[model samples]
Target: MRFLLIVFMGGGLGSIARYLVNKWVGGTLTSVYPYGTFLVNIIGCFLIGFLIFFTQRAGASTIFWRLFLVTGFCGGFTTFSSFTFENVELIGNQQLLLFFVYATGSVVLGLLATYLGILAARNI
Candidate 1:
């Protein structure tokens, strides 16, 4: 019960943050690309990487933080499902070039962001 509540709180916060980012990005950019979801996913990956390494370096179990931040928050914040759906929509609309760019860029940039986050955490 306690663990559930902690995850619930973290997930709620993450979801809210995701919503705000979507709104802000949507308002700022009017394009076929799913920039909002792409940005959120990359950011989530970076955050999870940083938190995992940082917590491990702290030399404590920190299970609660992991559950809340990594599992709950990141699970809620990242939108891989939405990313796939958007890709499908692009394909349906015959935007093959944009689809490939978005898909490949998201994957590559997300990995790079995670690696950078890990390096940042380690250096700190």
Candidate 2:
């Protein structure tokens, strides 16, 4: 239906954007971590937060926009698979403390960001 088409378009563009970020940060410019994924997730989080606030305060966000930006773009941008793989790689490499930090920080921070976004939206 129309909803599916909107999400599909948004997800396709989001994936393309992710590819560009990956290429930009791949191997040459950044090292020691998956900088591209990190950048995308962080940017996506902030954007989701901002959008939530905007959607709440303005009261003008349509279903199509929500499907596109949130269900599609944010969904496509954040990578649970990459996060899990990184954690496993860290653990396999005997970086226990590093793995702990990454895993804990990712979950905790991501949850906190979502909570804060909701709170901001409600208050504003």
Candidate 3:
């Protein structure tokens, strides 16, 4: 029950943060691309990577923290559905080039961000 509560609260917090980020970035960006979702996913990926690395390095058990952060917070923060929808929309609109670029860039950049986070955590 306690674990569930923790996850619930963490998820709420993450969701709120995600919403604010989307509003801010989405409003600021001039491109038609889903920059908000892309940024959120990349940030979530990096954060999860950093959290795992830091916890491991500090000899911390990750069971509860993982559930709260990775399973809950990150789960709420990242939007795979939105990303997929955007890709489909682009494809449906016959923007094949943009669809390919957005999809590929998100995956590639997300991985790179995660790797960088891992490295950053390791160095700390």
lDDT, each prediction = 0.83, 0.77, 0.80
Off by over 4 Å in 3: 60-62, 79-124
Tens digits of per-residue lDDT, candidate 2, 13-73, equal 8888888888988955757788888888877767666654566676654766877876677
Q: In terms of TM-score, how similar is model 3 to the real structure?
A: 0.57
TM-score per candidate? 0.61, 0.58, 0.57
Off by over 4 Å in 1: 79-124
Error of 2 at 9 (Å): 0.8
Best of the candidates, TM-score: 1
Q: Which window of ten consecutive residues has the lowest lDDT sum in model 1?
A: 79-88
The residue pairs in collision within model 1 are none
Residue 57's C-alpha lDDT in candidate 3? 75
lDDT of 3 by residue, 1-124 (tens): 9888878877888899899999999789978898987888888877776665676676656678877876678767875634665686799899999999999999999999999999999999
Decide which is better by TM-score, 1 or 2.
1
Candidate 1 structure, TM-score to reference:
0.61
